[model samples]
Target: MNTNKTELNDQELSRYSRQILMPEIDYAGQLTLAQSHAVIFGLGGLGSPASLYLAAAGIGKLTLVDFDEVDDSNLQRQIVHREANIGQAKVASAKSNLAQLNRHIEIETIARHMDEKEVNELVRQADVVLDCTDNFASRFALNRACYAEKKPLISGAAIRWEGQLSTYDFRNEDSPCYQCLYPEDNGQELTCSQNGVLSPVVGMVGSMQAIEVVKALLKLPTLTGKLMIIDAYSMMIRTLNLKKDPGCKHCAR
Candidate 1:
């Protein structure tokens, strides 16, 4: 009998004791979370908090995907990049920050945007996917990749004082993929840069997105079948059940 288990050492136990004490996410659940691999797109606003918590929680391997460089304006929300690292690529800066937080995890970073072919390759290896990009193009691109690979996705978007979160795995057969809810990608529109977003609003929503990623990996019950809407100003949270749009161009096939 192969009774081998990937057990955590005393130091790891000490680090994660609080999470293990929870009945739902006991030692076993914690172990599952630690061994999982997840990919996060755009290490900016949402990616900053999501990746930080994911790494701190002991996710086995994390791939930080981004191509931007640090800027003075980013300090308010892009917590992973330091002012000293301003001239550096976002991926390098973000990876170094994760290392400081938890050396136990592995970090792979790509400093360029990928298309359908390359995106699928990454998705196939990831246990789950996150869309933290600030643009509609990247979000839709990632959505196609996640749906094609059938990996659970935890996506987030925040602007002004509001944020929205949603998951798409369709493992249950009726949940909406990101495209099912957002079918068309109108080229001309408001972007994060143009409209602006509150720093903490991004932080709060990104952290919640990380929570969803943890839940998805552990096979725990989650808000996978719904979308979470948050109004940071009012501190209000609303969850709306999602249905697969039969005419959804991306997933109908």
Candidate 2:
């Protein structure tokens, strides 16, 4: 991971003044964020908040991938899409919002689902990969791609007042990949469409996903080998340590 060592411009210095004041994220840290690239799959509830926060924080390049259009039903939680964006491509809507947030950064949009080859190539170029998709198939594909590229992936999911988040830094050989946590589909795929989710439930989890991405770029201690489970109804949160499955197919090699 190259820091680039480029000095922040006057406008940049003023824009990130607040973040630069922090001990953990001084001007150097902010510059690191400015030089990093992140790709996020799925522009729904989770990706919405994650993209917004990442753009506001000034990630140099943000690649957004999603093949869905903005549905009227999505406004309740997908904060990045407004009522005007109904029926519009999610990536286009996201690009408009992100462009408005940070004109200094680059925002790339792919308005289609990525195939395996596309996923691998894109993951190879990104410093961070965020799996915000809601389906197991996409999650598994992203995990495989990230593991191949040895990129850090920040994954999050929310449905029916329940949410989960984890970061897999495949660059670390001992770290567990996403497959380690869910080896196979157990017939337990519940989506917000079927079960319904609290409005803020996704926001809570998505914001944390953004935090993990930022922390990962700064090389700060992050949730790399742990899973965070959240219950919005009970307001309870728990973290579990993750171990690599020696026999796991994706990362055991």
Candidate 3:
């Protein structure tokens, strides 16, 4: 993220004119967005829209991390990939598509999985982290890394017509970490492949994650310490208050 570049060029100004028109996100907010960097952990369903919107909205830099390859089955909900990219690594595929959307922004790709040290270093470089991974292991690893680095983490998940979104802003002393929300990870974890998910369910949740990321970069009010549950089958949404766990191994003092 180049904080040195304080001004938006003519083309950038015109490209982001619509979002810049809003009262809250005027010129300044857009510029702030242009200097921010976001790291997304997955390039699947949730990450597809999240990365697309962030790129189109002019996020200065995006680091994509995913070790999986694009399969034909992923085409149903992973909108950032195409049939031509079916055998390509997800991070590579996403970086290619996102670069096309916004040529000015920098898109970095890590096509392999990383250990704890690497994850922590990546989190330290990002202004915000987005957890779009599927399994509990990846989520737990990312949560620890973000909490350790004090970066805000925006996590989203969807399965079987249900989805959830939350932001854990570790910069705040009182903000809850992901471990506070899910203390115990049972061995059995549900997956979209097994239980199945509605296409739009992940889309809605992923889009919301993008909105929260923009809000986070602009220092605007965000979903910090709150969990949004979406039951797309019923067309209903609800929010729950998230409290920091005093005994949480990751965030507790």
Candidate 4:
């Protein structure tokens, strides 16, 4: 018998038996997930569901970063935070929710803004980075950090009834990064606060972010060179091929 074969303890086997039953995951892939680390850069709408599913899927370690407290406004789409959690650190509330779903994993929370150096270190340590953040400044900074660290980044955004998702794998030199898809200095950005979001739009996008994170960890085919755009009102989903910009300042060789 191969000693390196993925062996599940009685507890884990019972906990993840459904995942193990899937042909794509089975035992080996579940073990791969068990040893992987994911870093999420927000605990809001997108990060809420992303963190929850990632924890439930048994990622070995999850590092959650957010600098905000739960607001009554967040309760609309940020499902991880409850009315009782308002005024609490979003990361703490998220951790509490995630732990309830899966207590077998390690959850680390950072409830402050991270500078470039901090982001770089965290991205380097992570197998994948989920950019569920809302603002362009944070998104571009995270893009730079992930590119510098050569980590795959799962980027998601939702505002109103529209949402978008993409993955940038820095390991692939030809892949376009988040900056390539949009200008870093995008002006007058629309926010969920400024423009009302349908409650389920963010949840839909966030759930896909989790799916992309899992596939990235499992080495499965992902949206590495494509972008997905969703119009929830019309129920239309479209995937567009993304080309690396030769003049892209971020990922261009």
What are the lDDT figures for the candidates, one per model? 0.86, 0.90, 0.92, 0.89
lDDT of 2 by residue, 1-253 (tens): 3356487899989999999999999988998898899999999999999999999987888999999999999999999999989999999999998898899888899997667998999999999999999988999999999988889999999998899999999878888998899985645788888899998999999999999999988889889889999999999999999889898877887
How many residue pairs clash per model?
0, 0, 0, 0
Who wins the TM-score comparison? 3
| Tens digits of per-residue lDDT for model 1, 1-253 | 0113387778888988989999988998887877778999989999999999999998878999998899989988888889998989999999999999998778999999687899999989888898998877888888888877788888999999999998887556666878777766644656778898899999989999899998898888777778899998899999998888888888777
- lDDT of model 4 at position 248: 74
Ranking by lDDT: 3, 2, 4, 1
Model 3 per-residue lDDT tens digits across residues 1-253: 6688889999999999999999899999999899999999999999999999999999999999999999999999999999999999999889999988999899999988798999999999999999999999999999889888889899999999999999998888899988898875555789998999998899999999999999988888888889999999889999999999899877886
Model 2 per-residue lDDT at 71: 92
lDDT of 4: 0.89
TM-score ranking from best candidate downward: 3, 2, 4, 1
- Residues 1-253, candidate 4: write the lDDT tens digits: 1124355678888999999999999998888888888999999999998888889898888999999999998898899888988899999999988888887888999999888998898888899999999899999999999898889999999988999999998877777988788866657788888888898999999999999988988889999999999999999999999988777776775
For residue 144, give model 1's deviation from the true position in Å: 1.1
lDDT: worst 10-residue window of model 1: 1-10
Say which prediction, candidate 1 or candidate 3, comes out ahead on TM-score.
3
Weakest 10 consecutive residues of candidate 3 by summed lDDT: 179-188
Candidate 4: segments with Cα more than 4 A from true spot: 1-7
- Candidate 1 vs candidate 2, TM-score winner: 2
**What's the C-alpha lDDT at position 160 in model 2?**
89
Q: After superposing candidate 2, which stretches have Cα over 4 Å from the reference?
A: 1-5
TM-score of 1: 0.95
In model 1, where do residues sit more than 4 Å from their true spots? 1-5, 185-187
